[model samples]
Target: MSNGEMEERIIDHLRRNGKDTALKICKALAVSRSVANKHLYDLEKSKRVKKNDGTPPIWDLMETPDDPRPVLKTDTVEKVSEIVRTGGKTGLKAHEIARDHGLTRKTVNKHLHSLMDKGEVLKTDSNQWTSTGHQDSQASGDVTVSDSVLSKCFDIIGKLGKGAYGCVYKAQHKYDGKMYAVKKVKLTGDADAEVKALAKLEHTNIVRYITCWPSSQDWESCQDTSDQSDSSIVFKGSYTETSDYDSPGMESLSISTESESPAKPSQKHRKESVDPSNPSTTYLFIQMEFCERGTLTTWIRNEKKEQRTIIEIDQIFHEIVSGVEYIHSQNLIHRDLKPDNILFGAEGKVKIGDFGLAATLTNPNGAAIYRTKGRGTRSYMSPEQELHSNYGAKTDIFPLGLIWFEMLWELSTVSEKAYLWPDLRIQKCPEGFCVKYPTEHKFIIMMLSPTPHVRPCATTIKENLDRFFSMNHMLCQKTI
Candidate 1:
């Protein structure tokens, strides 16, 4: 086929598939891999497509000749203005801006970087840029969080993390004299579902909801009325039935109930409590215990600490499984469990956070509910999850295996040196280097088994690890 014909076919493939890897296009179009890639590059250069920089490049079509080119000049200026206006506080990455504005990622990145070079935008972090040099008033204008809003809380601290929903901040409660991690989620469709799912959970190993606060600001600063209706729907559910409020949002008050305290209310009563009815505003303030040690990912990546030993691994894994088992018992599936969501508390207690994608396995009538989104990190997701097939508790097991492997190996499986046990066994080993532990290795293998049904249940996994630890103790005694 001619180069033009090959390019057309490649574009068509990306359009049909939404996203297609070069290998897939090559195989489907009967073209060489290199030829397919060259065509993809040309298509991307022509601004007719884009590629997702994952493990493999997944090409996506941008626009066809007949399609109207989206007007991004207005969005670009508005986003920059928001950044400049927010005193560099509310900046979003190019990709995020692109997704929000329905524009091409390439176009967004190009304009954003240009703005950065011109001193109109400042790079806040990798891929995150904000506006600088302007005073708080010049940047925010009337859109600023009112002093009344600020006074209601003790002090708003720095950001903890960002997600699809909203940014989480570490804040101090002056009246209570307590530190709380406050998750400020923008009211959106799925956000309400997340709040409902979280309300059902009362595990010590999970993060507590202090409260939820809703905002009346436009979803994005674009002032585009078309998307405003969609935004209101997303934020409305969290504030229904509150008669005292006269705003569009509400704050949910949450406190960590994990501590053994007679001062705290019982979990049963807390679950049944409801806010007063209101129409103008609905907000929730979720009060959760602050995890000082940060996320498990941060802990693992920080080179300052000594490598985690086998015992530490056992302890951490036990905590994780116990928490997961509790979540399972509550009939909820944490669809997005990962190292980033696992956190360590003041006393080194491990707890699972970020339940935005969690789902209740059973409905109000106790019938099973199946989730369709298949939400999770790709590398840690089970094959069933990756394929968007039916999943259950077994889905969590896959990430458990990957986490264990990383803890033991001190490297990700995606690394070149991370090989299967069988392959490693065939090679000669130096002295003092121990072979992969039979029980632990077997456990990982079982968890990573291709079939979800064959994967060990959470209880079975916990029991197996307990037995393994017991056996290790016996072996140590013999050596002594």
Candidate 2:
């Protein structure tokens, strides 16, 4: 086939499928990869197609006008619908879709920006776009969760614990017969924002998302009916300033009193409470395999009483490194890599649980993205991470060292010995409590090399663990 014919076919493919990869285009068109790319460039230059989002730049076809010489509509609503349907809820850029469609990238990008300006398509994260209408609709249902979705998999049994995000419930899937810890985040503040961020990640060490349910009108109606039934009982008492009274307004008054009181409010306020009505907006529901052993913080504290052996410490360290390695492999920097975020699953399998502050290494749209402020636990943050400077995988190593130090020293010598260490004069570990390993001192130095460059990479640490384990095995054989 001629070059023009091949290009036309490519455009057709992209238009029909919504998106296409370079390899798929090349194979289907029976053209060389370079040749296919050149055709795509030409088409994109002509505004025939565009990329889906800032993500990997997958290509899609631009909708054409029916008139022989039609003027472009460039309506934001049309662009958003195209993005949502083609982008599969995970919106891509127009340029990316165009490239896949064998169209000029420049032309596609122009339309994308136009749509963004119209507020039809919103830029999510670095370069991704999603329908603004969709996001708004999702946000509106901030209270009620869907029973249809919830009923399929699991039934919540009891409360496990609570944290800054929401309550943890022990739930069991009816069909799979699997037990999972379901975290319900109420849609208040930036709960939905956090959930969107969390949804981007797909890693073994990270917690998995089951689904989200936005509050619906049906749920609101049910709640209203239920409230009316209880209203009579709730308001059947005389009022007094000091004494508790039953009144419809009494509950509201009590809420105000609690807010004004000198005494601290209930732990519910202090901790994160997931909103019930709008699971998607008010709360984010994340379901993952239950870790019966609890968090690394609790485990380490309890192990101190048991007087854990060096072998136990080594094993824990190894597991921690493995989980970190997985995170790095996915090009994700888990800024909050502390004992609190680490959990022990069945058979003491360590997994990283949170990604609220995690940052992707590369922009999904192939653009440079920057965050100004530092995030994650302050005590464990690397110097560069704390400064909010450009960072890579090495950014995570500093905290790994601190966790290792905590594991080795436990509660006893950690505080006193940490204070005795010489100041490193480094900006990252300013307290100078960080130390190198295998030193001659009775107290091993904490691994707090303030300089990110000096810190060991995840791969290097993994290799060291392998060597250590190998040597330990050899020693055991000799002793036997």
The TM-score of candidate 1 is 0.53
| Model 2 weakest lDDT span, ten residues long | 247-256
Give the alpha carbon lDDT tens digit for every residue of 1-480 in model 1: 567656655654554345768897787767789998898899888787888879797888775555343746744555644644464466666555656667665455556544543335665524366765432322333222322232355455333444333445455676887767766543433455567766777777777655554433211122135533333112111222112211112221222222232122112221111123312222234456777666676556653225665667778888888888888888877766666678778878887886766767676898544344334555456666655423677888777776665566654433433344323322222222345555677677677777878888788888888888777767767877
Best by lDDT: 1
lDDT (Cα, tens digit) per residue for candidate 2, span 166-235: 4455556878877676655444323444456457656555555555554332211112444334321121
Q: Please name the candidate that would achieve the greatest TM-score relative to the true structure.
A: 1
- Those runs of model 2 whose alpha carbons end farther than 4 Å from true positions after fitting are 1-135, 139-148, 151-153, 186-282, 365-368, 413-447, 476-480
Reference-based lDDT, residue 379, model 2:
54
